[model samples]
Target: MAKTTSDLIVERLIDWGVDTIFGLPGDGVDGFFEALRTHQDKLRFVQVRHEEAAAFAAVGYAKYTGRIGVCVATSGPGGIHLLNGLYDAKCDLQPVLAITGHTFHDLIGMSYQQDVDLDKVFMDVAVFNERLMGPAHAENLVDMAIRAAYGRRGVAHITIPKDMQEWKVSDEQRSKANVPMHSADLAAPLAFRPATALLEQAAEIINKGSKVTVFVGRGALHAREEVEQLAELVGGPVVKALLGKGVLPDQSPYTTGGIGLLGTAPSVDAMNECDTLIMIGTSFPYMEFLPKPGQAKCVQIELDPTRVGLRHPVDVALTGDSKTILQALLPMLKKKDGKFLKKAQERMKDWNELLTDRGTRTDMPMKPQVVTHTLSRLLNDDAIVSADSGTIATWTARYVQMRGNMQFSLSGMLATMANGLPYSIGAAAAYPGRQVVCVVGDGGLSMLMAEIATLVKYNLNVTVIVVKNNVLGQIKWEQIVLEGNPEFGVELHPIDFAKVAEACGARGFTLERAEDAEAVLREALAHPGPSVVQAVVDPNEPPMPGKVTTDQALHFAKALLRGQKDASKIIKTLAEDQIREVV
Candidate 1:
């Protein structure tokens, strides 16, 4: 039999080192599935319960491995379901390729069943989007799509018509007679360095200020040593963006924790007091948490010139690889007194002490911080941990200490729910035998609860810690704190996620009392297969901002006066947590 487009695409995927493809099969893409069956030994297909989970898994795989992730779906609704996850990949700058099926080429514009003009729908989300024209278009199109996804660090999409999936390519079409044959090996990533003159200018700006603070983001993940060196050389405290939480450990003396709403007081203070701000490999979006415009001399080092000065006004913008740029610029820096760093360290010590006290509370309704902090203690040193959006993200950000070789990620830019489990699935797939954990709120877990079966099907060793508060805790607080309104339509019906996990052939543990948290989590994490720990926590615990203004305090008071359902409980929990801080 002659080679078909489906076979050619699968072969090309293996060439590019894609070991797995996450998707759900439909008749529209049966030919591709058949091709996958033939190549099952070479490539694995992870069948997800939903197309969105498939896409999210792909994004997570890319994030963990720094390689292109591939996801597939059928025509129309299947393709549309992938939009949220694909947007997450795009917003976080992860390289992912999405392949979807289409209607027969003959019936494309006739408004046939499940016929979506996917190319048009995908234009804004993908760096490269196309529909396979014919058998001859397969090789070049696959090559170009993968290349575009890698080079641009965004999504690449392709829609294949059902009729064309089995169309055989002639020998001449495979040869260079009609189209140029492409190589399977990917070109090395560009390692450009900024000019020496530009580095010196940034250095001079850094040297001129005594109160320097370094800000790092996801881009600095690989430049940890360089970042530390620069901080040490300038005697500045390093503040991390939420996505860059793992770049430096919270235990480091030169560091304060995260910035923004889910950040620490020391980080906010560092930004406010610094006369010079050095941003490296980050485009942190919370401008309010940064220094006032022109209040600090700023220098931004980024790999993409287009994103160089995006988040702030910079006196010097140097575009290059983060590790390389920092290495080149470190030597030109002058040493300063450690007074600024020492002060920040003092603040961090107080902050850490407060967190420890909060996380160790033995109150009736358990604090969510205790769950995350306990999980942090039980996690393997090199575990890959992911958190779902909502108050769970806040808990994970504040309590889960990143040390050793631990890796952390979440729906950073998209801030979408239901990504927690899928990300763990992807992480487990990326590195088998390594420990993986997903910390999620009840609302987010309920959104994709069926994935519990996916975990069982693969026997992936992932421990999901579900914080069941019986309400949308994050949105509830946002209403009171940010909007000054009484909470409405934010409650979630309680779910016994542990029972659900057992129904899906996984181990399940339930923790209602605060004392049971550590043991329950330890057993779940060591279960050897997929496990779920349903932890019922306090709903009234607030996810307060790092730096709250008087306006926010007024808003909370107004919300309580406007008849919040749990006004009394809210005040009690808030006072308990706040009282600990003052002492």
Candidate 2:
């Protein structure tokens, strides 16, 4: 017997262990939805306002759960909307499968309404992209897409022709499910060990260096204990990439927070000052922040062989998983002199004091640091905090300490805004028991504020804390430092986000002053349904580097000379040790 191609898709997805699909209804996808309606218990559909949100939610699910995320959308404009979120997943190297409907095969070349070539549109973003040829290609294509996504650690896509979706699959196609694909088949390339000869060369280089620092990335999240042990053995401090921020507990003596511009003083100090830099599982770009070429030796352990030596010229490139390589190397080395570690420790201590003072200041307008630091205290051990890129990421990166079983995720390489709400929705949907919190700025929240309705519809336990600074804080500061120009197009009118949340059928709170922080946050977090807390943060607050560049100071002077507004305010922002804690 033969079954509809739509039923074949649904069944194959179930075999892939996917329980949920985020999407919107469309005429082209009616057959797929019909199949979904029939398989109510096994397959779930999450209806969202925009196709973009569906894609972002899938990205969040993949990132937070380490499972292949699935999302669906219909043809033409609906499929077009999914590109941005799919690009985010591609950039972050998360595994995702996007199933979209297309114009009927008969209408595709006829220039019929809503007929677009989805295959060509998704070519650059997807590692594997194609359309179903017939019912016979359904299971094979879907399996290949899923496998390709997990293997390459990127997005894979499929577009089903609206008419072909109704075609039947033969009984011969059904028997293929007997040899179901196992989860073990999706293991990341890092699971296997490198050659013994490669390991030996890496160990030799690591043991010879007296002043070394271990840098971790998202790949090291599962290997934190091994990373900490290796750091202890080398007498080195560990700096993190933004994606790897919560790998080592914040309180760890051997760990320093994230690197690059959004970094801590200790991480900056260690990277610039180390004689040997051991980069594990991260290909952190922005070479200026790293040790200059010929200044220090390097060793990188990356699962992808092509990515190794791509950033820095490597002395040893061990192509394997972070945990496997680190565990192997840990036994071969003796502890080095702690002189470099001591200097970093002292820097970290001083940095902590400055950060604490920054977060504790009781100013009229609540500082962004206070927003994150307060949340740090309110967070339960098992919370998943998703931060929007921009100024909010600065506060979350350096100020909040994600300890215990808590996890923190942000738009790292993509640096996109508006993902916070969708990410929280996906995270909460994936882990129904754990609490999900999103820290988003006014500009970011406004990008996808409508998604609040999605949260309310799901009745998820999500708390969105909006930082209302009324400015594009990160880009504004960058203009001053990078171009020596006063802020242009950075100012924004303040918005009462609490009101927006209320309109969407969720609990809302407004904390205008610093004193009301504790009470409002408590109320918002305790809300059973989706809640939003709007805090009016200080506009003068700035995030600078650990050591201010001469270019930065000269640029500031030039901006002031150019008759920039609030010169005095700019001076205060620069001088307030509380404001530029990272710098």
Give the candidate number with the greatest TM-score.
1
Error of 1 at 574 (Å): 1.7
lDDT scores for all predictions?
Answer: 0.90, 0.85
The local lDDT score (0 to 100) that residue 60 gets in candidate 1 is 92
Backbone clashes per model, in order? Answer: 0, 3
**lDDT for position 329 in model 2:** 79
Return the lDDT, model 1, position 427: 97
At residue 315, give the lDDT of candidate 1. Answer: 96
Q: Per-residue lDDT of 350-428 in model 1, one digit per residue for the tens?
A: 9999999999999988888889988888888899999999999999999999989899999988899999999999999
Q: Write the per-residue lDDT of candidate 2 for residues 24-97, one digit (tens) a residue.
A: 98998888888889886998888889888899999999989988888999988989999988999999999999
The 10-residue segment with the lowest total lDDT in model 2? 181-190
The top-ranked prediction according to lDDT is 1
Q: Which stretches of candidate 2 lie over 4 Å from their true place?
A: 170-190, 578-583
